[model samples]
Target: MYKRALPPAHYSLKIQSFSLLSKSNVDKYDSGVFEVGGYKWSLSLYPNGDKDNNGSGFVSFYLSIEETDKLPHGWEVDVNYKLFVYDKIRDVYLTIQDADGAVRSFHDLKTQWGFVDA
Candidate 1:
């Protein structure tokens, strides 16, 4: 697992003001652009969970690849990813991921991947 310096065992993501994340407007929030393995990506938070996937009451986080149009046909990237949530009360990040650490392939047909429930 990847680790950040905030603590010895967990990664950190700081959101300045969480008041902007409302149940009715979660679709508007984004973590903006970031880079990983020379590829562009972004994170999205669904505070109310993804009801369409029967994930209500749990938070939903998604990692999405950006600028897929730049890829050539049949291009694919294999990725191994993990998702985490800071547990303020416990002061630890609640990590969620596949135990097998399977590599997922992203290509022209699929530009994004992540857990619908986390």
Candidate 2:
């Protein structure tokens, strides 16, 4: 599981990737494997906006969570992603802020569409 310094224990999301094509969602995938206090957790990503967005542009994403008590599905409850950003001209650094409000690192992709399964 990937470790992230976020509030609460587990940090998860739904859906994963998209296609950046004409009239296509062009998904930006999020690694489904996440952890909280070292405990394994599940997540999924679902398409929220641009239900039919198939153009080239900055892709948007949100965080959704599901507890172990509930069965996994296409769309879960409790979604969370506090820190986020969208590149205007497309840059090399991926925006990611630490829980302490510090810019430590960045990635090549952004978490846009997907849902986390329980």
TM-score of each: 0.77, 0.29
Give the residue spans of candidate 1 off by over 4 A.
1-12, 17-24
Error of 2 at 8 (Å): 9.1
lDDT of 2 by residue, 1-118 (tens): 3354555543433222233332355343344646554333433222233344442233444342224334333432232334333333474435543344432221113223231211
Q: Evaluate residue 86 in candidate 2 and report its C-alpha lDDT on the 0 to 100 scale.
A: 34
Error of 2 at 63 (Å): 2.2
Residue-level lDDT tens digits of model 1 in 1-118: 6433332222245765544564356553678887666678887777777777777876777777888877677788777778766666678988778778776788877877777767
Q: What is the lDDT of candidate 2?
A: 0.35
Best prediction by lDDT: 1
For model 2, what is the alpha-carbon lDDT of residue 62?
37
Candidate 2 TM-score, C-alpha based? 0.29
lDDT of 1 at 21: 64
Q: What is the C-alpha RMSD of each candidate to the true structure, in Å?
A: 5.4, 11.4
